[model samples]
Target: MIFGNFVSGLIILFERPVRIGDTVTIGSFSGTVSKIRIRATTITDFDRKEVIIPNKAFVTERLINWSLTDTTTRLVIRLGVAYGSDLEKVRKVLLKAATEHPRVMHEPMPEVFFTAFGASTLDHELRLYVRELRDRSRTVDELNRTIDQLCRENDINIAFNHCGHFTSP
Candidate 1:
């Protein structure tokens, strides 16, 4: 009877429709939930490593579940543009790239802000809400690539660290 009751409790906990195969972040570690057993749940890391954590850990730890029905997620990209670059042009390009990206959310739209002014450059920040946090790395890579391409096409120079480059006129 005790064993049956335990099994029943397990079923109730693990049977949560939104609980399994969800992308979740606990602290700095983020992964997709793989399995839920009677005593523990398994998560597969980005590198495909499995982590077995007790069920109690979920209750005790702070967790960010990206798959909890609401798929909206916020993404930020920081960029440093050359000091002389047109701020409005930079803002326009950033917003355009973000909006055009396949994974970026359109309803919420994208925002560009002048975050700060540095010695060699002007720092700008772009914020957008995405539908899935699981695609964070890929989205970021694509965004950066698109930004780079746009910058080149628009003749907007990106700020780089101090490094001497040989020039022959």
Candidate 2:
């Protein structure tokens, strides 16, 4: 076991599925790698909690490195709109919001997808790349706020589930 861990550690460090300060997902935990020790790698997640993963597990299990080859990471935001809402306008608004964001990468540009017509709303996904992998969460939040404000101002309804019967007083 000791020998295996040592060997696995070297492989991870050298082959570099992920390195320290990289954003990665391993064994269901997605976070930034804070430390890489001989036996294990430690990560700090969004909540600031440390997750220690064994080097052997890293070698054995599937590891996803988001910033491995590209610091530009795609961020996805799925929003549902009222069935009657205009998709053309939605596309424009979504693209505008993404383009206006400071961290959004302009080279790829933002794309809007009309994914599905759900039970209550028309599902749409906005795909945009961010300049920094670490900026994913913040960028998403800002985009959400901007989308919401724009939706409200433009009188676009973001649909939600009102599945059950309800009475308005």
Candidate 3:
């Protein structure tokens, strides 16, 4: 097993699947690569915990290196509006919110999709992209706040689950 791991490490070094500082998701673990050794590689997850993964796993398992080709990442925001809300207005509000955000990449052109009609609401999805992974969290937060404000101003009611139970007396 040690020999196999050593060989796997050598493969990883040569193939360059992941490197120090690369943000990656390997199976259930997602983090930045902190160190790479012949026998193992260390990753620092978002919570600041260091996780050591066997070199063999790198060679054997699937990995997603978010920073590999480009740092540009896409974000999807899903929202629903109460039934009877104007669909056209909702689309416009979503587009305005996304396009006005400074961190959003304009070249890709944000899009809004009327995904489905839920039991009690109309579902919509806003898809947009950001230039860097570092901007993801802040961008999402600001966009959500902006969207909420915009929806309220437009008199659109964001939908929520409504449950009613009737018991026979």
Q: Pick the candidate with the highest TM-score.
A: 3
**lDDT per prediction?**
0.83, 0.90, 0.95
Off by over 4 Å in 1: 1-18, 163-169
Look at candidate 2 and give me any clashing residue pairs. none
The residue-by-residue lDDT of candidate 3 on 1-169, one tens digit each, is 8998999999999999998999999889999999999999999999999999999988889988999989999999999999999999999999999999989999899999999999988999999999999899999999999999999999999999978999998
**lDDT, residue 32, candidate 2:** 90
The 10-residue segment of model 2 with minimum total lDDT is 66-75
TM-score of each: 0.80, 0.88, 0.96
Listing every candidate in turn, what is its Cα RMSD in Å to the true structure after a full C-alpha superposition?
5.3, 2.7, 1.1
Clashing pairs in 3: none
Model 2 stretches astray by more than 4 angstroms: 163-169
- At residue 94, candidate 1 shows an lDDT of 100
- Can you tell me which runs of candidate 3 are displaced by over 4 Å? 167-169
- The collision pairs in model 1 are none
Q: Which is superior by TM-score, 1 or 2? A: 2
What is residue 19's positional error in candidate 3, in angstroms? 1.1
Model 1, 7-108: lDDT tens digits are 543763865632777988876667888887766677888899998766655655687788878877888999999989999999999999998999998888
lDDT of 3: 0.95
